[model samples]
Target chain A: MQHRLCFAPLNGLILLVSACVLALPMPASAQDKVLRWHDNLDRAAQASRESGKPLFVVFRCVR
Target chain B: MNGVDLARFEFDYDTTWQAFFLDANLNVYSRYGGRDEKSADGRHSVASLQHTMNEVLVAHERRRRPESRSDADLQPAPRSKTTPEDIPLLKAGHQGCVHCHQIAEYRALQSFHDGKFSRDSIFGFPLPDNVGINFDLAHGHRVDAVVPESPAAKGGLAPGDVVTRVDDVPVRSEQDFRWALHRVVEKRSVVVTALRAAGSKPSQPVSIKLDFHADWRKTDLGWRKSLRSVPLPLGFLGYALGREERRTAKLPDGRLAIKVVSLRGGGLAGNLGLEKGDLIVSLAGRSDERTLDDFKSDLLRRYAPGDKVRLTVLRDGKSLELTGPFPPWDTTDTSVP
Candidate 1:
């Protein structure tokens, strides 16, 4: 019964940790799969060629 | 953007943000961003961007279709690639990074030095409102509203019509329409084609001729960063007086009351002996209700290089006159910043 009691807390702790990890925000690299971005034009052009998708080039003057 | 193809990717240099929709071969499908003096983000919307993306996708698919091989629209134009490094003036001016506004500035300065500069060059990428057509924010090329008695209205443009082309240039977005309008070098009538849908019938193409008058390309130049490069130099930065300040100066409402706060050294105002705290009451002997921008636009429109200007200033408790001739427009030396 004492061993069962100790194992029950360990199971509960594992469940709580799993939930926390699942709830965490996705990493940028993973999210990039949905909306890929490339700072370099050559890489973006290559991706566009391979995927047969159009390129959306944005020229932003931050200043 | 150092190696960016200037010949293929031309846009409004003054805009802080711009987007180009292109294909894998670097063939431009359409442009997606433009702005007016109203606000930077006023003409842009997420909905409009989505609409443009969908349209571009359709166009891309159509181009890929085997049967569409004969389509001229799918063919890329022959253009000689020119980058910022190709421009000698720009290369000579800056060492590291070259800005978009600097591209326009150096080009204008070079044109001025080459004696090919026109005053109209100062105005670039005019808004469609100049033609009296207000585009829908959600659908960039769709007419949301047409000003009554405007050129668009008189030419049979109505709200809800989808603009297809301007002067035979296919307009896929509002920026494309502006690009077509910007190419209009002379004040003349240009054809605008649109598609109108009635009830359940197929959309029918409609053509309208819009007559443009002189000064139709002019817009609020105050927000344009490239305007600083224009040879028409306003040597002093003037702040418009508020109602309280105007009343304190005994200036009536709806009258010009600009307070000169600072002067550029060796500028026209400094050369005219315009003081730092001088309250300018009138310009060219007229006092009207105008903001600082309106005043600047008027100054640019009314006077040319080498033209004489008279300013009525209120110094201390007395009024004084400051008159001087503008420096020659082409007097800018090789050391242009």
Candidate 2:
């Protein structure tokens, strides 16, 4: 069973902080895949030109 | 937003993107550790790393999963975290707000509650006059209403309970709650002293630490996305700490400015009738105030259920008096991207 989890907006800050205290931390094994910020193009921009919205990049955890 | 959809939408082929991300992360994570007190402070640093990756993956999947759902528009995607990193590209990829954090951003957010990014902007939000919390109940959640799903829920708190104190401070009023919050300035998770009200008498207190959302909404501000579809330099745009009820400031004219972030939410920001853009040059006839210290004071760390306080603010260049309650919370973590 894949137990899903959610964290703060900080790429690593939230998880880093949570790791210190969450009772049963969200284990790496819970999901096999992860979000690697190697340039999703949209993630690099400051604001959007088309939608006039900033990009919300989400990486998935593959279990 | 899910992997399936992300991959499906791709009309071209490029395996290079995946390879670079994995390799880059290996470097960043390698340099970082889970338990470095000097850095991460002993606690569960490694656990935090794990959670960070965990949330990333979950967010990616959440965004992508819905595209595959039978009904596309009918079934909305799940909410994502609203932190800075999630804002896609609010800032051009050039700016990294490593130093200018929650505290630094407070200045830019002066017109936040009113939705005015600038004093010259024609649009803004309808902010309440005061923001306050009300946590007048037993701890351990004997009452469903008392349990704030955000912190209390994470702290393993359910409704129908009793909270004697946070960090050993007897919670008698809302001000006390604000003080409690201020006390835990840097504590990731604090020692929550609680008693279950389920029994004839109070149950033994239980202490637990939880990872909660930033609780920015409590600050009495609107976290607005871009008015247009264009990407902003940052995502999740809003006040960092939200707004305090009343804050005294010295205008260039040497007049005491009283600005109230909000009193409707709760806390000193509210108890004192603090309003948006109001300034306070003094409190109780004393102009004693510390800018940075107040942002990171232990006294502010104790905000929890059933806390009360008193505060004063300057509104329209006039001093205003106010008092109110600050209770625990349950919130719309919709911003959790």
**Highest DockQ scorer:** 1
Model 1 CA deviation exceeding 4 Å by range:
A1-33, B70-78, B235-256, B261-277, B282-294, B302-337
Per residue, candidate 2 scores C-alpha lDDT tens digits across B188-297 of 55555556654676566676554534532233111221222111111111121213323223344333333334344443453444566554454334444433223212
Model 2 C-alpha RMSD vs. true structure (Å) is 18.6
Candidate 2's docking class is incorrect
Q: How well is each residue in B52-161 modelled by candidate 1, as lDDT tens digits?
A: 76776777778888987434443244369888777677777766666777778777777777778777787788788988999999889999999988789889999999
For residue B185, what is the lDDT in candidate 1? 88
- Residue B48 alpha-carbon offset, candidate 1, angstroms: 1.0
The residue ranges of model 2 lying beyond 4 angstroms of the native Cα positions read A1-63, B1-30, B33-258, B261-277, B280-302, B316-321
RMSD of each: 11.1, 18.6
DockQ of each: 0.24, 0.04
